[model samples]
Target: MDGQLPIDTRPWPVRRDAALHDQTMQQTIGVVTKRLANAKVTAYAAYPEANHWRQRAVEVKRQSIRQLEEHLATFTQQVESHGGKVHRATTAADAIQTILEVAQHHQVRSVIKTKSMVTEELELNRALENAGIAVRETDLGEYIIQLAHEKPSHILAPALHKNREQIHALFDQDALVYHTEPPASEDIVALTQYARRRLREEFLAADMGVTGGNFLVAETGTVVLITNEGNADMVTTLPRLLVSVVGVEKIVADWSGLIDVIQQPALSGVGQRLSSYTTLVSGTRGPDQWEGPDEWHVVLLDNGRTQLKDTPFEDVLSCIRCGACLNVCPVFRQVGGHAYGSVYPGPIGIVETPLLTNFEVLPELPSALCTLCHACGEACPMNIDLPGHIVQLRQMKQERHMNAIGVTRSYRWWARFWATPHGYRRSMRWARWGQWWFVRHGRIQSAPGLAGGWFKTRDMPPVASMTFHEWWDRTRGKRQ
Candidate 1:
């Protein structure tokens, strides 16, 4: 709504601590992530050729990105040829303005939206609501969070952080406004029926339908929507006017390219062979077509995407929002998405957010959000080097002198001590003696200053009485 990514003002520690203390959210996230992760493992185990397909997808995405400008130009030409309009937006503000202008020209009073992470980046729903246009999220998870006034906690399951009881409470409050009876019980069927009854009317009445594209076929000017639910189908077909806001990075060269990566999101995200719906829209309705939007518009948003080209971080653009990495990330599983306090979350977010924002937003994400686990890289179908990127980001942060003076000094002192045998031995002896202050029963329970963070939730055994080097010399013969 404010035409900017919701970069949280709170420090990372504060946000992370809040998430850690929220037992309900933490439990919900853990359960869902484990289920999704297990599903993906089952899916891949059944399909031995998955790795091959994943590699092909990575190559297709890389080629498309290398030729992004050409693809965009061809895509725009084909869309226009098919009676669709394309608007290029260099920034989030530009995209919002273009969408608003389209809505204004069409006299659109209300809009229906499918799940769109890019639009979330643009804060599209809030912008439209501020302009007096009613907007409703039609995706089941999106709808729940929309009513609860919360940002999505997971990429695929927006309300994965919320349990059934919490949803019942939100739905009960919403029912009061509609003057409708609440569900007889907290049954999933009863809840879904109530939502369907409420949203079906909006689907029929909305003047415009907005969606985010999973892939854009440059060869045919087609926008692809893959979802587990049929909401995207309704959003595309029922409204008089249609607007799709997609990142430029989503463009693929042709149908062959689209196929290479089409199944990756579903397979890696929820372990399905395919989603329930795959909606493709090329343009406005033709005279022969009876059930399609009268007008179609595509907004190609750069929003700093082009800047990644020809850089080491270029592969970060290949992300398909599959959320596989989130499921495997230990930190994400424990703390969830909201703790990252960025539009994109999990491993890829730690790399992409700072890169896309030119390091002006969430600069500490690399250091705070990740544990350098390569699990995300293995889970990613796009082969993005998330851990590698995170390391580079930390280096970049240091080069920019973004770390606090005390922290920098501490690291330097530690590094200097570890760099030499004498210093290392002295430091080890000092640590063994100093740790006694916080030791409880044989483990160091806590410490003061920076080291305290590591001991906050977990304890460590005190340094061994003898170093490995000392033990080697005393027991086995010394190498020299």
Candidate 2:
């Protein structure tokens, strides 16, 4: 939405700790994620055989990722079979160059885009601007972030961190929508209408329409774009050329998989049975057809995805980006997406970022984040097993950091020591003695060293003089 990456670029702990204390972010993220969590609950309860549908999605996704190349080839051949051109991009630069070339061929001046996270990954908007072409974000949340010069904080709800008053302020600052009435002062109806009226001009004048594919059905060579606001339809309706930049992983063999693709994401994301618009593009509009683009193009992006198929992270390729994981993630609920410092955020982002992008610099990303809650897996409509994938990444990271032989030995020593009954009791007794200095009124009011910061906002109960096992044995003996 910001037309730029909002990565903090600091150490992970520094960024996370900063976001933790940010009262505004805490309030905003907490309320929004919790509401989405509740909505997901209500939505799932209403659906029949929801778990069955989820399992079906997982099966479909696994099948697709395993034969990703075949499906992608079928998708491309079918698109070309239908008179649409397809470009295969191995990197972000390739995608941008492909899009630019398409723009050149079409003599594109202005472009109106729907919410496309892959496009954001390519920084397509900024690249277009650099090429002296104008780009407008048609999605409402995306538009706000574009105006604010900030990246999307959430995958589905880009402006999740901002409230209505904040949104009104953002609109107020935009010179494009200003008039005598000042745009209805926090009225959702007025704000939407104001945006709709203005965006219509952008849509009408756009030479090209760009979108991200939710699912590409290979059998018929169709690109599916879903949106709740009908903005994608508006963008596609009148442009001279339509281009979809899609990840190779988004392709499915046929229509049988498309229904679950549509329904599961909607149920997990906005809790809707279906999104308001599910636009399917096969080819350029014919004279017999009502109205559509004159040209159609599909850009299939690799961007390190090929490497994932054989790796332990292959399951990650199956993600549908429904963002249900984000809604239920305790870590995401607190810090939000910006703290993760990636285009992809939440549980999925941490797992994928290293695999897709620079693992050298972002080596600690997964271990730095994730509480290993498994809530993400429960929420994932595709059942991607996010925690399992995270553990793999952690193992990979630990191997690299295993150069610290002393730290490894000490950690292993402690882990083994604590595993024995005698060591456990001795350690517990010593820990109780050690904490006696910090205990007050049945709680450890403070802790020493690095632990002190943790207790700054938290309290732990003091350890009892006797172990639970000892107490249980004595109580049982008395009962007997």
TM-score of 2: 0.90
Among these predicted structures, which one has the highest lDDT? 1
Evaluate all candidate structures by whole-model CA lDDT and list the values in order: 0.91, 0.82
Q: Distance from true position, residue 189, model 2, in Å?
A: 0.9
- The lDDT of model 1 is 0.91
lDDT of 1 by residue, 1-480 (tens): 112466767888899999999999999999999999999999999999998998999999999999999999999999999989999998899999999999998788999999999999999998999999999999999999999988888888899999999989988998999898886679999889888888998999999999999999999999999988799999999998999999999999999989999999999999998898999999889999898889999999998888888999999989899999999999999899999999889998898888888788888889988888799988888889998999999999998999998889999999999999999999988998898999999999999878988898999999998878789889886555
In candidate 1, stretches whose alpha carbon ends up further than 4 angstroms from where it belongs are 1-4, 432-449, 457-459, 474-480
What lDDT is obtained when candidate 2 is compared to the true structure? Answer: 0.82
What TM-score does each of the candidates earn? 0.95, 0.90
